[model samples]
Target: MTDLPQELRLVTAIPGPKSQALAARKAAAVADGVGTTLSVYAAAAGGGVVVDVDGNSLIDLGSGIAVTTVGNSAPRVVDAVTAQVAAFTHTCFMVTPYDGYVEVAEALNRLTPGDHEKRTALFNSGAEAVENAVKIARAHTKRQAVVAFDHAYHGRTNLTMALTAKSMPYKSGFGPFAPETYRVPASYPYRDGGVSGPEAARTAIDLIEKQVGAGNLAAVIIEPIQGEGGFVEPAPGFLPALVAWCRENGVVFIADEVQTGFARTGDLFACDHEGIVPDLIVTAKGIAGGLPLSAVTGTAEIMNAAHVGGLGGTYGGNPLACAAALAAIETIEADGLVARAREIGELALGRLRKAQESDPRIGDVRGRGGMVAVELVKDAAGTPDPELTKQVAAAAHLRGVIVLTCGTYGNVLRLLPPLSISDELLTTGLEVLESVLAETRA
Candidate 1:
């Protein structure tokens, strides 16, 4: 474990002199494009707080952008990784296959939703999993066109950048992206004039049929609960409708559960919430308990469509990552984290909803399980309040809390606390947010 006391403690200021020094060094050494949300350099992290180099333990609400779902340095993950490291670090799966990789594949196929005969392939990142999923879909369907939803975040790779929606940080100047990719409206209830799920689905379907006909479409990918897109949960009936359409149209429905997989969304996967099984599912982030591992799990037929030489990479399914994934999955099941995520949602959503009632600036509170967020607005008109969101999050960070802001407008305050966090720590984090939000003016 990244060992330290579990409770939040402040020995020095948030970004104390030591952290400031490191920040200066980082500025000189690291690329300017690589951004940092929190200025404090992490010394260790476990349970609910990240102990900074300055000896201040700050509450961690982002969970490394939902990567450390089982909590950073979880005992099982640490032990498994330690063992695998001692055994052997890398041999390249493409050259010499390993048992850890096969074991992880078996686990993903069995644990992921759906009882159909499935296959699994491992990758090093969510973007690779996604790219491969697209490749598999295209090969199987013998089609070229693929569809992604608005506000979706696939990855930073050229092909994925085309699939992703937001423009600024994720897809600004990196143009000449891969071709034959399209975007459709997602069922965002708050933003879509409160459109019902079925209606929203119909609108998107109509657009797809007209702009990118099903005859040419290879896949339709979506995040059951969007991650970078403000943690937006699609309205009920939306996912199922899309799945049915995709099935009828001979199109592969890909669920990008990269950030919503494993126990982060109250269920093992966000797709489980709606009982919507995708033709292919992309997972990462929480999969390895912070170790870099991702996977594409789907029906055997579609997966096999890819020629043997088509998929896989050098570091795909590294032994240490595979070991960590297995242990992390074991921890999730044994600790009843799925139910714990539900409990967290109840607590956080309740508190945030109460805050919304009191503060008009809080435009909306949405999400399920441990993945909850509040949308900041300038007025009752629901105008985005990016500045207020920034101030509130900065205030929280300065006062020893680590919250993150997201959404296309940067008006969302997303909270992804570790499931292992204590009620007291979680409650205190909420209270800190409430205080910061309350103290705000203009």
Candidate 2:
């Protein structure tokens, strides 16, 4: 990783020969359903750059879709995982409980929003964490229905598919989804007729009361800052109001902070911004540096409602992943990554917002901390322009900058640089994006 500098070095064309060859192999061997955003294969990555198979070092603004918050192969994470591997690989926390898992659970209970008596359950993926959260919520509340929001993206499993609102790519042919899941309008400030936060909350609550009815709804799951649905930070006052309503109605409020947790959002958790402590907080993506780990943290009573056997999975808290998570959490706290995320957000958003001033194609620039986005549109009236978004991202990619696209309409370009990234490297990535936007036609 020391050899992999934090600067973008284009030794060859974007994909280069080696990457092109791997792409050919991937075409032949990999499933078509599994799509990749950047075609370049990573040979090594650290700090802010990904050294591709072709030896072209690309500036990473996507942070592996918000997973590697401590950067790829971070020292603490690497050391922890290596020591754990040397000690033992897996006993499956279910079969044989481990200290690492318990330590991670303790860390989450302490770090997540609120000073309540909390308990955490570990899982392998964000989807699993969400599923387990819903199970616990239903068990605790003794209700059957759940409510999700517009532009929401929960996961790919049947139950999560029902929770997600997108169609074309995520939920197109994947129907026969879990029943009793309802959808409500999120407080998208930019497009909601200029409704205030309280107003939007009232609108959502009214719909929930009228349509789903709190009596039948066990929980209402939401991403404090929506990820694939675009980095849509709901209007201010919106979250707290909803949390209050949920508390009054005996409905579980689940904060799916899978993308916004663990210092990725310029805070330990996005819910911290509004002081809205959800009943159950589902977290992942940036939890374990680069390891696959997710957790559901909530009040002890709600978490324990699920039967003992209902929560444990074969690899729920794999020793290696738990070790990695503990180290990642340490890095976040010891390194003051919460402040770093704020710094990155200020730098990226300052530059992008400046660029937005001249580019009418950039309809909006929105986010908090390092979790920022540029929403492309056709006109000031804000007709979504997904095609233009693709062109801008492709141009940046060709120039050795790795950016990612999202949104229910696919017109949003999200920038989630690792908190470990240097200011110079992040600025350079944003420069590439600025240039791409300048040249890209609407």
Instruction: Output the number of the lDDT-best candidate.
Output: 1
lDDT of 2 at 289: 90
Query: Residues 84-196, candidate 2, lDDT per residue (tens digit)?
Result: 99999999887878899999999999999999999999999999999999999999999999999999999999999999999979889988999999999998977887898
Clash counts for all predictions? 0, 0
How far out, in Å, is residue 129 in model 1?
Answer: 0.8
- Which residue runs of candidate 2 sit more than 4 Å off their true CA positions? 1-3
lDDT of 1 by residue, 99-145 (tens): 99999999999988899999999999999999999999999999999
What TM-score, to 2 decimals, does candidate 2 have?
Answer: 0.99
Regions of candidate 1 where Cα sits further than 4 Å from its true position: 1-3
Query: What is candidate 1's TM-score against the reference?
Result: 0.99
**TM-score versus the correct structure, for each prediction:** 0.99, 0.99
**lDDT of every model, 2 decimals:** 0.93, 0.91
lDDT of 1 at 284: 97
